[model samples]
Target chain A: MVKVENLTVRAGNFEISDVNFEIPDGKYGVLMGKTGCGKTTILEAICGLKNVVGGKIFVSEINVTALPAGARGIGFVPQDGSLFTTKTVRKHLAFGPRVHGWKREKVAGRVKDLAEDLGIAHLLDRKPHGLSGGERQRVSLGRALAVKPGVLCLDEPLSALDEDTHAEMVDLLKRLTAENDITVLHITHSRREAEQVADLQFRIEDGKVVQM
Target chain B: MIGARSDKPFLAAIGALAAMYLLLIVMMLVADAIYGFGVVPFRSDNPDQVSLVSIFSQKEVINSIKLTLYSCTISALLSIFVAVPTGYLLSRYNFPGKLLVDAILDIPIVLPPLVVGLSLLLLFNHLPTKDANFEDMLNDFKVPFLFPKGIEVTHNVLGVILAQFSVACAFSVRTMRNTFDQISPRTEQVAQTLGCSRARAFFSVVVPESWRGISTAGTLAWTRSMGEFGPILVFAGTIPNKTEVLSSTVYLEITTGSLETAVIVSLMMVTIAIVVLVAVRMWDRRNEGGLYHG
Candidate 1:
């Protein structure tokens, strides 16, 4: 569960005023907007990457406004599929659990299980340099989900894909999040992806959130 | 399409350049042999004593070479530690006097070694140092090894390291800055969202992503340190067994009319340079296909 009360952020002269929202646990909440909205800024502030001018953010009822980005249990995927070049897919998946200090045996089994489910089992040995667009996105999603985060924050996860692949990705995401009860705060201009996957959708125009 | 033939001219130019470089290497290798032949008549060693060629095999030559390696290795490591972070900071953020810091770093590359040595001489001695000048305390007491033995950075291996490090660190910082700049900072932000700290994201994501370019930079730094001469000579001097490096050794031998030993040391230095430069070029070739952190 996550809640933002009177969230206000100013990136130079740009200000997002009175941005308030509440995400119930396991709910797939989507931030739907036309373009140039406060969607990504809200996401960044929630993760503590950017400081809020005025507001309180809570992760599972714990105030996390002042907390560091790493301390907040949110898994994120950006618009671009930014995978590590030097690491294999398996090692990329091992990143979060390693940060949290999971044992070697535990990390291996967990990575293998996730790789199998994501259908990236064969691609695990490969680097990100030559992976196909869909394959890279799958790897990005797997990296985010590998840690089993409390909230999954995706900023236009399929924005960079082709038309056919974008549709395919939306379907795959719906199927993957079906049973995990992962709270998702997705930012997108695409109404199709937002409508297809979200239980509750909000349009963020300028800096305020309005129910659509 | 029509552009296929257009690139042929550029390709031809590159091929010609490669051939010229190869010819240059062959010429350099032969120059030492020619110099050695000219100086063979000089009284090197009688039947009782070892030959001049065997001077390279002597414990003094061997030990100086090893010490040179030691100095270069430690300096390179320290430079990377200090400079990599500086590079990342320069690439990612805009801060006060960034241009001034950049201009200062560029000085060592263009400046003479003697100037670097002289400047370091001032800093180690008493000449308006930043924050804490320890010269006052050192004057009062003759401290032992761990402490200062009465102001002694001139004519030492440590002075040599400072000189080489200033130049080598500039190269490392410039290369690594480009590497980090090429990486999209969005990836690190994403990692941060996934419960990875800022330091964690740097180590786990950015560093690994830019490792190939970073390795190439390190190779360049190592080769630069190996070929280091001027600053070492002025600051560290051509000490018989203590401070003499390969380059300085070659210089000393040539000046003292021991041309055979000079030729041998120069050959060895060239060989090491070729190996490292080739390795760096190989790394550049490997990554050119956009494979490793392009």
Candidate 2:
């Protein structure tokens, strides 16, 4: 579960004021907005990647407002996949588990499972630069899920995908979220994408989040 | 047919100009290497003149070469150590007086090398004397190590290292800053969200990504330190076999009218610099190729 209460954030000259929302446990919540409507900002704030000027954030009933991003137990997949270019897909998948102090064997096992689930087992030896757009997105998703966080925040994960690839990814995301029991807060500008995947929907207008 | 005919002379002229510029530089270096020292080919008429073999075997010259190599290596490492954190800070954060700090960091680069050396010499001259009140106070508080006495930076190895570091670090910082600027902060943010601490994220992600920049900075600093003369001359006096680096040795040889020895040392410096530059180019090409394929 992820909850934001009266959260205010300022990024450069843009501001998101008095935002409030929640994704119930194990549900897919989509935040839809036009370009630069602060959807990504809210996701960043919830994951502790952005500083909150005011108000609280709760993750799994724990008030994580003051916590660092690392301690918040939120997996974030930024737009563009942002995979470490120097690392192989295997290393990318294993990075989170390794950082979280999992045993090497456990990390390896988790990486294998995630790779299989994401249908990226064949691309594990490849680097991000070698992967196609969809392949890169799968590697990124695998990396985020490696730590087994309670919440996954994705920022326009399918924006760069073709129509066919986007639909496939949406289905994969829905299935994976349900199977893993992970609450998701996915941001997108496309209303169709939101309707396709969201259990609950929120729209951002003028830096404010309103339930739809 | 008319347009093609007209373009021929223009292209040929520009090509000729480019080739001539490159050839002129190469010819100058070759001419200096072969003739600047007044050495005649296949002739031993001037037996009194210092031979290249004799200069290479000279204890002072050999020692200066070693000192230059050692000091440059140490100073380059030190510059990188200081540059990494400084570069990251300058790139990532906007703190109070950030612009001022950035400007100040560029001071040593723009300041005359002689001025840097002179400033260091002056600074060392103000080191606390053994009987000074500050030293006495530290001794009284059982913290004498905090401000030790009798430490001399001028005319010492420490002085050479300091002088080189002062200028080398500025170049390194600029290189690394450009490096960090090109990398996306989101990569690090994603690392943090994956449970890595800020320091861990920096070490594991940012540092790895900037390896090319670090290498470029290190090479630039090392080469700059190797060529440094004015500051080292002022702050660290060219004491034979002690503070004498390759550049200083060249100056000393020239001052003593041993032009042959000076030219030999200059050739050695040029040779080493060329090798390093070629290696750096190869590394860059390999990295670029990796990016293209990966």
> How accurate locally is residue A77 in candidate 1, as Cα lDDT from 0 to 100?
83
Under CAPRI classification, how is model 1 graded?
Answer: acceptable
lDDT (0 to 1) per candidate: 0.79, 0.89
Q: lDDT tens digits, residues A1-212, model 2?
A: 99999999989998888999999999999999889888888889898988999999999999999999989989898889998988888899999888888999998899999999999988878877788899989989989998888999999999999999999999999999999999999999999999999999999877678899
B46-122 per-residue lDDT for model 2 (tens digits): 66756776677679888998888899999999999999899999999999999999999999999999999998887
Looking at chain B only, the TM-scores across the models are 0.79, 0.85
**DockQ of each model vs. true complex:** 0.48, 0.60
Q: Write the per-residue lDDT of candidate 1 for residues A144-164, one digit (tens) a residue.
A: 888888888888888889989
Best by TM-score: 2
TM-score of candidate 1 versus the correct structure, residues matched by position: 0.83
Q: Return the interface RMSD of model 2.
A: 2.0
Best DockQ goes to which candidate? 2
Instruction: Quote the true-contact fraction of every model.
Output: 0.61, 0.70
